[model samples]
Target: MENSAGCSVSLWQKIVSFLLVIFPILDIYSVGIKGIGIGSIILCFILIGMGIRFLTLNRSIKLNPYYGFFLYGLCISLLTVLIHNDFSITAVAIRMTYFLFYTLLIFLPSSYDFDIHFAEQIYLKIGMAAGAFLILQYFSFWGLRYNLIGLIPGLPLNYAIEDYVEWMDAYNNMYTIMFRPTSFFPEPAAFTQYMAPLLILVLFTNVGEKKKLLKAAFISIVMILSTSTNGIVFSLFIWILYFVYINHDSLKNRRFPIFLVPLFLFAIVFAILILFTDNTISDYTVQQFEGLFSKNQSSSAYLRIMRGFDIYRQLNFFENILGIGLGTYKSYYATGVLTVYDGETEYMNSLSYLFVSTGVIGVLLFIYSLFYNVPRRSMASHALAFLILLSFFSSSLFNSPTYALSYLFLLHLDSIKNSGD
Candidate 1:
């Protein structure tokens, strides 16, 4: 009976682990409350159950020191809120709650003995499922002239056909027929952001070469089909970096071979530009590529990458050192001290959000915690860390439970691999 109970508990842990892995995608559903999300509620329950189990077993929980430092940073943020007297205390409290939740989640996998390999398998399965849906979504929309979301009943997706149409219109102003498949996400960029790190793991890690190449090819095709400029650019960047890293030993013995990757990419782009003339999708892609360097304040690229710096520049010295306050971005936005685009209150860039909301000290502590357990000598560890950091620049992911879980899972995978090596 004891053995059977142990097996059941183990099964329960595995189920929780799987749920945590997909929590980012699960965040879309609303549980009939404002400021309360399904993912957060599920996480709260998981943690509470774990807490009860620990207490029952009389197990002493020893958290990582970084979590202590993170708590300290939150305290500092609280102090900053007190000092500012202009930000919302309630907002800071709410933000602290989520931050605490995320910190505990970072420690959950190790405490529960969640297998890193199992997590990787979950990621791949998610990629495959999303890719399949994306393909069907694309064909169903373009060929059948039907929005795929409409066909699915009771899914409660956060987006509607009008939202997709608006996104499609953004990509091509003159021709609105071009459809980008978001799969389960609210937007194409979100889908790509979620998939980017998984792409890196499958391509760069020592996962079976045959399976890795096939998976990478399929994912790359999916990202391309999604038509997110961020996805396409990130995919190209990583592939080039991977090629260089893989051939570094051979290239060290020779010269000039390192330049071939860029040349190859350039050739492909040039061929596409020439062959796909008069094509709406190709023209829209080219337009977005050019928009990446646009100085216009309203361009998506500018809003995502440069707006954070603009906001950061407006901070007074004290605010710069300690930030305005946690979760105070909306309050700060309401102040109208700085010009914002599209009336969107949330900052697009995570790094910028971290800096603007948490201040310099908070940023340092967070970065240190993020890299604390990562193996310094392992190339895979560095690659995963780099990809995680890169993903932050595209959106407000610093406080996201999904990104936090992904970061923890990847680091756990690296530690496991390093120990094995």
Candidate 2:
């Protein structure tokens, strides 16, 4: 009837499950829904779980190494909050969750393979549902607007969007009213980040689940259609690596670099064909790649990172060592103490975001929290390796609360076993 050593329920498990499953959908950050303090909510649930675990289960606090990693982050975050009293409470809450994560509950004896599968299934379901819901809103011909000039979310709202993104459209109302299916997420990037782990879930399935795989592919493609190229590009790269590694037996024995060689050649050829078929995409890709080389030449993303570099230079050695502190960028910008050479727009590259916000030490702590929690023995080693590589280069350490979600997914898959050593 229950799971958790001899079928006794561990409340910690439930509390964490609630967070991972519900948080993405709730997306507390969308409208800056402040008040009640995010920290308060987390603390309340944490206390409840611990109390129940202690009273009912007699659970032991095993000396997990990852605890130190989280404690470090918690220390950094608290220190940041102390120094920057006006820092974002929400950001602090997000960091806190990472230091103390969902993995702890899974480490308990009661956690099983099914729990892993169940958690992953819920995540995929959410992504698919969000994808379907938003795509339906984009069908303008159906005349599905709310109050005539309908919101893409199909909701009746006074204005279509809060702000206009020049990348999408100049008119704010059109951006909002004409649906680009960002789904339950705030934007495509956020949606991509959420889907990243699901991709891993797909590859790591110990058994067949082809139908779910198809859904994941469809949702992923829909996200790309909304014009989020970076996340999807990197995600597919990771998926390719995952596919190649899983079929290692064939890779080693075959003359083909297993299937990767053909796949790579196919992608290049398809890209060439695409260049002939569609100038817009071809031109954009050429520009994005070419921009990487030019001093000021590159997509807005390259510029953002460059700008971050400019800001990083301005950070004093002490700030460099310890980091500027979480959520400190806005304050620094407002005070005219910092600058992003490329400037920040919604699609800003995340590299500079890390330095400007946390500085070096904070960055290290962030990395430690992820790599450190890796399971003692993980069969999906290549998959785990690919995720870490993809996450850092392609994403901001903090943007979209990715700092935590990325870490959570990686650690769960990284968890090692007694023989893994």
Q: Identify the candidate with maximal TM-score.
A: 1
Mark the 10 consecutive residues where model 2 has the least summed lDDT.
149-158
lDDT of 1 by residue, 1-421 (tens): 1121123235765667677778877766546455555777887887888777777777766766667656765776677667668878888888888777877777754535455556666778888899889888767766686666511234333333323345444434422565556787767777877777777767666433566656766776677666677777767766766666667655566666754644565456545434633366666666666667787665676678777877888888987888766777776677786666556556558888778876887678767776776666555566667666776676677757557766675566643342113
What value does the lDDT take at residue 169 in candidate 2? 44
User: Each model's C-alpha lDDT?
Assistant: 0.66, 0.50
Report the C-alpha lDDT of model 2 over 82-194, residue by residue, as the tens digit: 77676676766754564344444333323421244345556666767666765554454235443111123432211223332332343334454333345555455566666
What TM-score goes with each of the models? Answer: 0.82, 0.67
Count the clashes in each prediction: 0, 13
Which regions of candidate 2 are displaced past 4 Å?
Answer: 1-19, 28-32, 35-47, 62-114, 133-180, 210-216, 252-298, 327-337, 343-351, 356-359, 379-389, 397-403, 414-421
